[model samples]
Target: MTETVEPFTWHVAQDAIDDLHRRIDATRWPERETVDDWSQGVPLDALRDFVDHWRNHYDWRSTEAWINAQGLSTTTIDGVDIRFLHVRSAHENARPLLLTHGWPGSILEFRAAIPRLVDPEAHGGTAADAFHVVIPSLPGYGLSGKPTRHGWKVEKIAQAWGVLMARLGYAKWYAQGGDWGAAVTTQIGRQNVAGCAGIHLNMPIARPLPEDLAAPGPDELKALAALQHYQEWDAGYSKQQQTRPQTIGYSLVDSPVGLAGWIYEKMWAWTDNQGRAEDALSRDSMCDNLMLYWLTAAGASSARLYWESFASFAPAEITMPVGASVFPKEILPAPRKWAERHYTKLVHWGVLDKGGHFAAWEQPEVFVNELRKTFAAMD
Candidate 1:
């Protein structure tokens, strides 16, 4: 089936920008948290400072220009329009690579890594390290069209990715992802889709079996403890998004501050920062990510993904060649043995001393190096 591919240019209406500012300016103040730290959530003082910066200084047009500079295109696949960035490398033997992003993230997450991956020679890498990259906006997340019906789960998204790679004339390709993206890429491996050479994940989701737990090693025990800590402390957003996304969607769409606070807290909790999210991500970068959600009015639509496929994306075995980079600050850091249970042909495993959930966004150089090394081994 031939699909119509159209060039995409991003432009936010002036009125929408004005309205966002008005909302930010008119935001009602909530009482300060009872505690001094961020245990309750984003601290009132920190949020206020961030909101002031966002409203007063953030530049959306510059961000739009940055996006426009990429090879942006959209195509209708399986009755849904998908948006993606297709950047081909100048290197003759460049491998096609599909990169995916997860919740609270968009195609922008991979912006910095794109050029380095696509034109490695220009970035101190050999031509052999080059990759023709395809970074897609997950359905209903960024510029991609939202689903009007049900059944748009990760499995379906994985199938769509296969179709996407095929549509782009990639008969054989590699894949990489983190967060919800890890789930999608893992499904692609599990399904053993044609043309999928292998996969690399920054966040590999693997659970210890009952028997494995019986005789856990030090790393496995630490992993299990981290998983438990995450479920107890950091999973409220997941539950809300999975069960009642629509309820919070109203607030997210109507209030820019509300959306920022929702995502900003995760930045603090998930990133390798020193008590502040800004320490890891610049104010402009955070605003750029927030604008993808704010401009698209994707608050409810994006959250619906959790409702559609969170539980279904639990850890499962994948037989194909696999690589993983376990960042120290990830919500749940799976040990090598634990991941090996699922990734039978685990080829490359790197335990980095730094970085977090948003690997590419937080540490692009380290992230790029990991991908290069991981794929070189598998290649």
Candidate 2:
């Protein structure tokens, strides 16, 4: 018999928000180090302003209301109860598309893009292009129940997603993700699910080539140069999370400001629009994403995914048609040649005009446009 899953429950207790405020107020702050770039850390002044607003003015209830307004649903799959926002168009024959989020992120990442995907009419698109959207909080992230076991690696999570899609009765569907979501999509492609037609990803992992390895053409060499830069300068979080998640968890769990700073710095640095996190992302939006981690106590569990998959880097020689929209500011961009070695059915690849690691959150319009164009060609 097929497994039965329930709809999402949207509610956040007042005491939890209050507790967050209490912690922010009682935080035992550390001495600040001046004269350091963002590399040193989130600036003290920026962190303080965010905390003051979080405690004094930010509205958790309104965030909850906006979430409810989206009309999301929750479900249980493969013994892990999952929370997701499922949206479908009025057209009965719309295609199914599963959207997954990555670490330091929640389903909240797609808040702006969901409506456009679901009811394209509202966003100047036709019903023919609508998708039955399934945006799930990865296991141990957001409202999804924390994993009780140790083996929730990428492959295992992909299996769970398969069960989720089948439970929803989607015979054929597409998958898209960024960050770890990109990693998960690679696993889903590897699963070779009979009904998975094609996969779309903003983030694609390439196998590391030796520096002495014979170089490809100029384009490929440029891509390799970009990858090398990322490894050196942009990978500290990976090192910490993969080795000592618990140590970092202590500070993040105790202080909301600490968590915000931890996440905000990365967002500020990695986004497509450099040095414009405030203009690109509002303080409210940033706090809302952080609140998901804070309320769920998912700091360590989310980090552990890094530890488990740190070395399990599979450069998938993907047999299914794969499309990648590469953003310049993306932490790592696999060269088209290197990517070709892994994806046998690579059909679409574009160095996007703009955006960075968090494509949807940072450059939603560019991201949405790319999706429409690529999927249209395949359709």
Candidate 3:
């Protein structure tokens, strides 16, 4: 691990932006989907419209500016250069909080919630709820350096996080995440790493063990049915990413439309949108996330994490204080009873009325309040 942490800034070259537009303009699109709905994937009409806006009206520089407005830094940990945004609250005794983003998402997901978290008083809360926020671009995603070797699974990532917080001189900290982040945070809790105060997850991955399944109740059965539904209808992306990331990587890295459609489908399918994904998330926000994957060429490398650990990324029993905010439309909303089985010391649990897999992005105010309420008792 290198002790030096360097300040970082994002500046996409003009030529690169021009090239991206040219590619979008010249894309060889496929025929429209057979169905009227999003069953076959991102509808050709929707993707074409999105690409047109991306080519003509979307402003990448504004997104870049937004990211640069936050405090950015990079450090080498476990042989990879990790980029992160570290924002400290003005309030003394502010708690240290580390946030992790999942696949098909980036640190951009938390952009709206950062100010509220770091300076709660300014966002209609007390200094007592302030947090020193740190949001890292996951390895092989966004501005973070892609791993050259093959061993960058969730466990290694969790360990690297421990090292990261320590390097920042934090003696104790809370961790929070959704999706892959949830997996990493869960691992951190299970490891009981020194200085890790507790963990909170928006997507709690607590499944019924074989025994629990033998005589399950309605909630457990509902959770199981949801999991089954995911495996059946919603897991094709995971299957491909886990089995043939490089195959899909070729298209994702080579074609911006391919990358956009790939991610756009998830935004549509996974969000709490009634019919269209844009109902819950704006085109700019969706495009911002797509740009992270496109600019970094992280399509394959990021997907490789699934190949590396999907089967093995099962939830472990954790005794550390745990908090969960269950979004109703999450990929799989584990029942509180099921979560209690895995999170033995579950200190907080909130069943959100709305929101989905991308809770922070979909409902920033709600997400922030959940974090504040979840961790308040910890203090």
- Candidate 1 has its poorest 10 consecutive residues by lDDT at 1-10
Cα RMSD of all models vs. native, in order, equals 1.2, 2.1, 1.3
Model 2: lDDT of residue 204: 81
Task: Compose the digit string of candidate 2's lDDT tens values, residues 1-379.
Answer: 2267665557888788778878888887777767556657777766777778878988888888777666466677666777777787677777788888887778888888877777777887887777788888898887787777778888887888888888889999888888889888888888786577788888888855765247566766666677677688767888999999788878777767778888888767777554657766778888899889998888887888887786665677678878889898777777776788788877788787777788888777677666666566566
Cα-based lDDT at residue 196, candidate 1: 95
lDDT (tens digit, per residue) of candidate 3 on 157-221? 99999999999999999999999999899889989977998899999887777877898887777
lDDT of 3: 0.89
Where does candidate 1 stray beyond 4 Å?
none
Would you give me the overall lDDT of model 1?
0.90
- How well does each candidate superpose onto the true structure, as a TM-score? 0.98, 0.93, 0.97
| Residue pairs of candidate 3 with colliding backbone atoms | none
Off by over 4 Å in 3: 210-215
Q: How accurate is candidate 2 locally (lDDT)?
A: 0.78
Q: Each candidate: what lDDT?
A: 0.90, 0.78, 0.89
Candidate 1 vs candidate 2, TM-score winner: 1
Model 3 lDDT at residue 27: 89
